[model samples]
Target: MSDHERKQLEDFLAAIEPNIAGYNYSTFSYLAQKKGNVFELAQGRLVLQGVPATSESKHFESPNLKVGFLHLHELKTSVKQFIESLLTGKLLTPHGELRFAPEKDRSHSIYFNPFHAEGVPFQNRQAFQYRQMQLHIRGDRRERLDSLSLDWELKAGPIPFEGVQELCAEFGVGQIDGDSSTVEIVAFSVAAIGGESSVTGTKAKLVINLVDGLEREKASIGYRLIERNAVVKRGILSGDALTWENATNFQRGVAELEVTGGAVLHCVASHGGRAQHHYWVADPATAQNPFRAIHQAFDKNLDVLQELVTKAQTKGANARDLEIAVAWLLWMLGFSTTHIGGTPKTSDAPDLIAATPFGHLVVVECTTGILKEDSKLSHLFQRAEKIRQTLISCGNQHLRVLPVIVTTKTRDEVKSELDQAHKNGALVATIEDFPQLINRTLLVPNAERLYTEAEENLKRLQNPSPFDVSGTKTNLLQ
Candidate 1:
């Protein structure tokens, strides 16, 4: 692992150290033939027997007993799973309780189901049993705080035959037959504890195989974190009802939910199916930001694009390189066969010509220099107008002309000129906003809607006058 990855692992280990200490665990580290840096956890000396008479029994002098083994490559996922198993094992211990209490400090406790014989309501009496449990978590900030607690219940029963069939859908995992008495229904709350700012009252559920008897198939665990307050008012009723005019509170609540939800998903992925794990953040307000989604979609390629943009700025940008990069960006935004126009200082043609899928032609004039001076502004306007005329004369009335000036910085003078140009007909967009625009365009699956939206925005910019006469006598009477 790299230094950064090792640090991440160390931090994670430290975060869960209290829980590990509660279980009296220690690590056994050694080198393996196939795996590097083999780390295993245990509580006491581990010994292996039952070998052939000719071979002597092997014994480990380490007092720590082995409870889990982890591979470095799967460090995060494995650690998460190990922690879950530790929590579950502690709850199922004979004492039915686990406490994390230090000298001269507040104590936290987890209480398991002291009464496991109780049957679930409407369950097959002979087939299943229910057990209620609770967990109390304590922490110290600036002052002593109330213990954060979570209550939960579980139902254990025999695994069904269809469960085996469904397990085949995921890659890996051997086939199995016959019912395994290992299914469980887990309902618990993931308490958000720390300071007053911490979000509380989040519930989650998991239904899966509980027994570690699956030969090659890990447990099929599924989980979801539920936040009751994460809701927006659709509309108000005629009577006294709630209405959602803004999403500020909802957004804030969802952000908290993401933290708790991400943890639960991480644990599930660790124990269930790491490759198939998928978590959906269902915040419509955040989803509307196409730029964020686009960044996520191109996360792997963003560094390369950023590097190119930086290189262009650091080394005086070559016109050809900038044009080619812009062309590539257009293509990434779903444009097909982008054509770069006019050699630098040679032709008066537009810099780019492309068409939307719906036949809406786009003519673009690209530049990399700041338009701070009147001469530069005038030259840009003339070029854009010329391009607009050329496009109109082509007889394709569906064409849309966009003059784009790319620059590293925007001064007040340049911005003033660009704003005026935009009001007239052109668009002034920074190089940084290009990714956002591209993502927004791609988000609109319908070509006609995209074209219409762009045209409407431009028209709105061009017309600065208000629709209503605010100072008129008619307006005053109304």
Candidate 2:
């Protein structure tokens, strides 16, 4: 490749990175303890986790720094907005713009944008021209700059502990105490199937780990008897270990049944204040495949799926895995799914294209980050509309294309600026409603209904529910 082409490729790759810089930035921990209703925060030192200890010396701490309680309300909304701006590459702030600096651990840290500093000469200041290029090597032929300017680099700063302290004082939010609060940090992992389950035509044995102290609740065991690519029978069954009162720790549940063919089991147990699901396939060949676990394990394990979805933007491999998982999710919901984002590089089309046999089409774009300035919603909308136009030209008048953006961010965050997204007939699936969608898919497994619900959700956002002024009864002639 020519030097210019190589540089162009590098710029394109950087632009698509979740964080142009600071991809390896480390996070610090602070002391915090729950005291009654509030958490008492204390000064905490930063430590290297994956990075080496030698890099710690490069971090300079401001003198006389102390920690304070985590005030219930300390301009949290503003802080969130600031963080969102940084994540979205908007580079809007009262202070200088931020830039990525190299750390000793071969990682990057955020600092004030050095190129735009006041003392730097205008001509000498380095500028990275973000020209349009093929995000993926092949897929789309023409390359043109997108409407939004996504040229801002990633940024970071020192532990904002003292900064938060100063802000609290300035805003009269609270006072900082030199005394640190006592806190304990624990790494909690979700319950899983620790022991191997025996699967036969007559019965299946399931062993699961339940939380130590949490109350054990009811278990929902449902199965589908598949024969010749058809579900001959489907029903719920019960077992002893399905309930913890009868057994302890890793309990084994024996599901008694008589079947002549392979069966698919869906076992959900309620424990640790959450529902844990495990899938078992009867065929040994199916179990032997490497991706069988990812296909089945990740289906019901929403927690791990959520983490992978959240990291999709940052990690290329995670993005591919997320696409596969999403496609599997759609398939589970009875939709003919296509994972189009499996290209070696980023693709031009949406991540997934799914359709119900009845001509109900959905184009989905998945992201765990903010969808504000440099969002893919617009791109998705355009693609969906283009598909609709093409289908119409092909004389498929009954077909409908619904654009949906699935994000791991909460509903409130995605709802902050919904007018534009709703304006383009796009529905957002936030983290809050994502689990509901998954559970509903598993329980119902109706693609037609899901598409209808997606359309209704978009319509509801467009119209919204009417507000009542008063509770007074109005007389007909009053």
Q: Pick the candidate with the highest lDDT.
A: 2
TM-score of each: 0.34, 0.43
List, residue by residue over 1-478, the lDDT tens digit for candidate 1.
Answer: 2455345435544433322212211221211011123212112111111111222222111111112221212222233453344334221222122221221342222222222222221112111112222121111121111112100100111222122122221211112222210111111111111111222223222222221111113223223432322322121111011111212111001112223421222112122222112222233222333433465475543454555544454335644555555565555454553554656565555566656676555555444556443244455567666766776788765566555454433232244555565655655544444433433322323434544655665555566457733211110001
Query: What TM-score does candidate 2 get on C-alpha atoms?
Result: 0.43
Measured by TM-score, the strongest candidate is: 2
RMSD of each: 24.3, 20.2
Instruction: Flag clash pairs in model 2.
Output: 110-156
Question: 1-478, model 2: which lDDT tens digit per residue?
Answer: 3455445445533432322121122222332222343322332222111111222212222222222222111213232242333233222212222221122233211221111111111121111111111211111111111211211100122444334444334332233343322111111222344335545655665555443333333333455655433567776544333644334433334445566634544444333233334443454423322333445663444455555554653423344655665776677666888877667574877789999879789898877566653457777877888788989899996898888776655444555656777777777665444333443333325678767766765666677666732111110000
Misplaced by over 4 Å in model 1 are 1-299, 342-346, 372-394, 411-413, 438-447, 465-478
